[model samples]
Target: MHLISQLCFLLCAAALGNAVVLRPRDPVKYQLKTPPLDTPWTDKVGRSPWPQYPRPQLRRDVWNSLNGIWTYQAAAGAGDVEKSPPLLPYAEEVLIPSCIEGGISGLQKWGVTHMWFGTYFEIPQEWNSNERILLNFEAVDYEATVFVNNVRLGRNTGGYFRFTFDITDQVKRGQLNSLKVFVFDPTDDQSIPQGKQTKRLSHIFYTPCSGIWQTVWLESVPKNHITSVDISGGMDGQLNITVHSNTRQPTQVKVEIHGLESEYATQRWGFESDQLAKISVPGVKLWSPDSPKLYNITVKMGDDLVQTYTGFRTIKSEVVNGVRRPILNGKFLFQFGPLDQGYWPDGIHLPPTHEAMVWDLELIKGLGMNMVRKHIKIEPDLFYEACDRLGLLVIQDMVSMRVHTNARPSDAEQAEFERQLEIMVNEHKSYPSIVTWVIYNEGWGQRTDYFPEFKIVDRIRVLDPSRLIDAVTGWEDHGTGDFLDNHHYADPQCGTPYYSRLSSPYDQSRIGFQGEFGGLGHRPEDKHLWPVEGAVRTINETYEIHANTDSYNWRAHVLLDLLKQQIERYACSGAVYTQTTDVEGEVNGLVTYDRRFVRVDTQQWRTDIQALYSAAAGRA
Candidate 1:
């Protein structure tokens, strides 16, 4: 096994590739927001703001909290675009750990995209030179650049994955040091994976988020520290773990395994060359969606220790018992669940809280869904962690920034799009719950900006051969992708089984899953929503006082009824219900926008879901 991130940084150098580059400073920017919280005991002078522990995967003690009220200013979207803007008064005040666009961030999640944030802190004189500094960002949209005082540290792209910078050399002990970050995001632009984010909130897409969407903090580590680690164990009685370090060489590297009943499991091993080790046991326990059994894992190169967990499972779409089905642990199991469009009413791109992350799947479980297709947007890693622990299967979708905006990057744009896509694939390829990858959603932004790109089917196939990939979701079905899929709005026509029969040459199923259906509307009251609710509106909000949707609902309900008719009519495979909750103005979610109300009774809804999934599981 190699460093999970070995390929993550192997960009063809500009000297070799002669790539065109842009100085992000060319765009106007906004300074950061630092709102003062009103906590009775959470005053800025005393308590540590955002003092919670950072890494949930590997827990530890003795770290510092860098979140708190900080100074900020907005840069002229035009003036001196290449340089940080000077501080301005009454610019904006917001909470440290929240994005400038999120409600909790003490900033609105609307009408703001370009901005910069800065904060200053003094290094404690008592701290020794033996300690190294680690500056971590949970997430920052689009592009980011970091500077200490005035010296450039490092830069990072890709909004989904966590990025870090070593600032030890820039910070002088016993002296005040300033940290600054610049961010720019074209919400609906043809670059970057903005997921369903839009400058204007509506329909399915919610408000856009700029700057930090997650948490930011500072940590002190020994000079020789563990940079990163990838822990994965497979079902064939094989376990693979790799550890990355900041030093050139280490004296020793070792890891211990536990949880398996066999004594061979609870032992230690050591190695070098990126410090990865492999262990295989005979007759290992296999993990399935039904029984999501995970094991404990520990890693240590020297003095540093990191703990995590891994599940042993393999996913495949197979014809078992003469039926095309998603096989898990060597058994046919219908993958069924909500189309999880991870969004929030108040926070937009940001989930309101950490627990806010689990509601989508918890509601799915309540509705008897064993699996979920996390449509179009890759969620924060915590969401996957919950799926791994909660026993729900996930078909993760890669984000699309240019899809809705009709972005047709010239061959140049297309090339950049591919690069961004590669970043997405490598960053998220490791999760156990992700059984499939969705290359395109409804062909939103095709390369032609018109026709479909059959090559997409091939692109997805190459990126992640370990899992299933769907090149396009709604229309223009290419004879590629691991499965078949289509969208039906007012007629819930679940697709056909004959299609599954056509892919036998590839050992793939012709049957396509209903990538979308069942968009029943039910909005929440007093949600403080953004203006211009999406076009997916009732089309006539008051046409019928008591009716679902005067234009789409009554017909949508009848369409769902029609779909149920077709489920048994076509003898289909499976489906992913339109959405889990209402986003912005679209009220199609199973739960209301506030997440406080369930549109349908929990038990009855679950039963409805179970029937659709089980029936579609086996495509004969």
Candidate 2:
């Protein structure tokens, strides 16, 4: 009976054209390429690289993940791309969410700029009943024009921020719907916030991600649904929430706040579109790296419901003794962590799985670090969620772009840059873990510092006055912002000055910070190294040591002493290590790129960090 039923199902599927069965699992047909080093989660990446819910802050229960094998084709040239959709089903296949350049994508077509990605999805009957069905893309590099059922939906321009489109009119209910996307990324060829992506991959810069590199999904929302929620926590116990809706009419919103650990009375408020609502919670525990407490919030208007979480904490700068310090919740605590370059050996710009991202955070926590300088790249919401849940303070950096060599951006370019910056702040402002925003890194894409009227830093301050602003992390200093930052990659032997000239009294209003230091390089076994043609081991004047347990311990000890000196002697409030993992040819990370092993002894590292924290506490 079982065999007969299976036979009947296959016959029926054949009768219906077998769209689900003939979804193309044969990799040879597509001629895909795999990376040399595979992460542990690489094989587990079956179809979807990150199948989890894309939006954690604004989440609905019923959603469909449009991730899996997708039809892929590299355009013949720029002229090959046209207004209409690409030819129906391409012979090549690429995995969604993973860029076409990365190994996890199954198509390691690196240099192709123009490409077409097509997939088919079914709109559930229940989803069709909703007033609106939305299609969302977590991120697409450079430029993207989307099409649903061959009908042009819209286009998005940013590579690091998420965008959505209403596909209610395009999708067919209870039937397979066609989705096509065209992406063009001119990494170094254009003046954009390309981060470390470059046409030439060498030194600090690594691989370039071209197409869809994050999650893609479909959501069912009401016509008058809640669009956004801006939650801000104050030191005075007041929780300010501004609930935004699509409808202009005033609507009754029920806000339910539940403490994950502590008991708190639920508060209610009536929400109007674009109006601010305030509520004070009694005995609110301030969120810190030590005790990161989050409150689950549910916002419901009419039939629209969305769930989100936020932590209440206050961040400010105050003079402790003679030196200014970043104070959190009216207390002084030194921040120290690695500069996290969110890159993977297999996935390049993205981690292979959600668990992989969480693993990196957990490793940082276990190493006794309190903060992470997310260097020059914006991660997905899942990264921020893990940081909030695990109590890791984040220093987010706006992606940098040097339009011209050490030159100012034209007026038109500056406007677009500010637009992207505003989107970055508005999208991630609700996350309590983000304490500082680094505006310019190593003078990338920065105008002449002499021009006080440039006012990019001022613009950011206007957008978000809650978090501290870092005008410049290294090299060129505008003599503004809350941190007098410097990037000093001292010699591994401590032969060079640990601090730079930025520590002078010229900026009395800013706190001293070692934005980057200690690029101690150590290449692991050949298996862990990223395989690239003519890939030279670009080790700085750091250290040359064996990859043994004892050497790794010594390296960790030396690093601790170096950071301790910065805190005690220079009164530096924070310091960021060169990086978390090695990228491409750079082998100066605490961990290998594949994430299979940690070079340092976790237990010893944690013990040393704990001692450092104790000393810092006494100083505070």
Candidate 3:
């Protein structure tokens, strides 16, 4: 009977032009003239390029992932691009979501600032009956102009934020649809916040990437569907939810909150357009790094249903033992982890696969670190999701650009930065793991004027008051924001004058943190290393290591002891270790550049970290 049913289903699918059997074509492999260090996920890129659902926070089952291969061409200028119409054939094929400068993209040739991408996809007949067809781009670097079926959809600027266009009228039903994208990126131009990207790669600065560096997809929704849902946790143990709809119709919004282990509560409320639905979970389990509890949320309104999840916890600054420290869930707990710069040797800005991303966070957990400072670059949404599930706290940094000496941005550039800041907060506010936001790092792309820093801090606080803000991470403390962050390097035991500088008077209300410290270098003999021009230590200089185990033990002991001392001597609330893994030329990481070797013993590190957490909690 099962075989008969399967046969009938196959017959029905065949009758509908075999559309059910049709799937996205396998991505083509691009042979780069110069290859990068091979990772576990490198070979999988051509077969399945980030096959997971792009958006995990607000999920819909009825959507198509527009990832895989697409036709690509490089244009010299706008005039040269104007020579061809929309949906024009391309000279070569490049993998979507991988930048042209990377080995995975097939076209590793750099120096071309302007480029075009084109692809053809057939819309599922079932999705053609919706009132709105939205074409969503998870992210596109710098600037982008999109076209569908030879009709110009829209233009978007800002490389970090996501954007969407309503292409319901532009697409044809039951036919193949055409998509064209034009991208322009002026990396390190000083006007834009290009993060750590630079045209010329060097000691600190890395290679520049352009065009669609993230996922692109299409979804169908009702005319009066929910556009967005914002969730936050209150100290009073209540969940605050605001649902925004596209249409101004009165509708019933049902919210069901389910604990990961058990069912919690279900409630229905009348929502009109944009309405705030505050539901109280009487016995909610507060989320923490050790006990990361999450509640699955299901929202239903008429025919529109969306799924999401949130954690119940609170973060604030309070006086503990005569020193201002970060209080999570009304308790003083010291946060310690690595300054995670999300970059891959093979994928560059993009991770090779979802598993590789999860592996990084899992390693952090295995090492017993409770928090991670995501330095400079804003990662894809999947990264935040992994943090939430794995119980790791995140301090997200706004990507900085043009970090030259005394850099300043124009008024328009400042406005663009602020706009992207708001989008970043709104999009990822639901995640319970993100407890803080780092606005600027070491005065990169920051104006010397006080008003600009004041405005940025005020805007971030206004957007989401639940999370703490580090207005500036390293130098030039504005005396604003929630934390006075500092960066110290080399051996902490040397006891340089920098320790005395940490005693400088600052805001009494804010907490203190060593934003970056402990860059002890160690490189394996077989590891791939980028050429460094300057005089720097290639091996462990502070401690003599006769063997590999000695290297790992000495590095871990010195760093962990320094953190314990920092907390006791300076009343420091938190500290981010220099990095999680080695990158290109930088060999100061707990793990190797290719993630093949972890210097520290996982069991011993976890035991040491637990002792630090206990001390900060006032239990020891």
| Top model number, TM-score | 2
The deviation in Å at residue 349 for candidate 3 is: 0.6
Each model's lDDT: 0.60, 0.78, 0.75
Off by over 4 Å in 3: 1-34, 79-87, 248-251, 260-270, 491-507, 530-549
Task: Quote each prediction's TM-score.
Answer: 0.80, 0.91, 0.89
lDDT at 555, model 3: 68
Task: Please provide, for model 2 over 362-449, each residue's C-alpha lDDT reduced to its tens digit, 9 standing for 90 to 100.
Answer: 9888888999999989999999999998999999998988533556677676677778988999999999999999878887787673
* Residue pairs in collision within model 3: none
lDDT of 2 at 243: 79
For each candidate, C-alpha RMSD in Å? 9.6, 4.5, 6.5
What are the runs in model 1 whose C-alpha is more than 4 Å off? 1-55, 58-62, 78-81, 84-90, 122-128, 200-202, 222-224, 246-252, 262-265, 273-277, 282-284, 404-407, 449-464, 495-511, 523-571, 613-620
> For model 3, what is the error of residue 472's alpha carbon versus the real structure, in angstroms, after optimal superposition?
0.9
Instruction: Supply the global lDDT for candidate 1.
Output: 0.60
lDDT of 1 by residue, 264-367 (tens): 55766777626546777554576666677777667665667767667787777777555466666666566667788776644555565555666667778766
Residue 89 of model 1 has an lDDT of: 16
| Number of the candidate with higher TM-score, 1 or 3 | 3
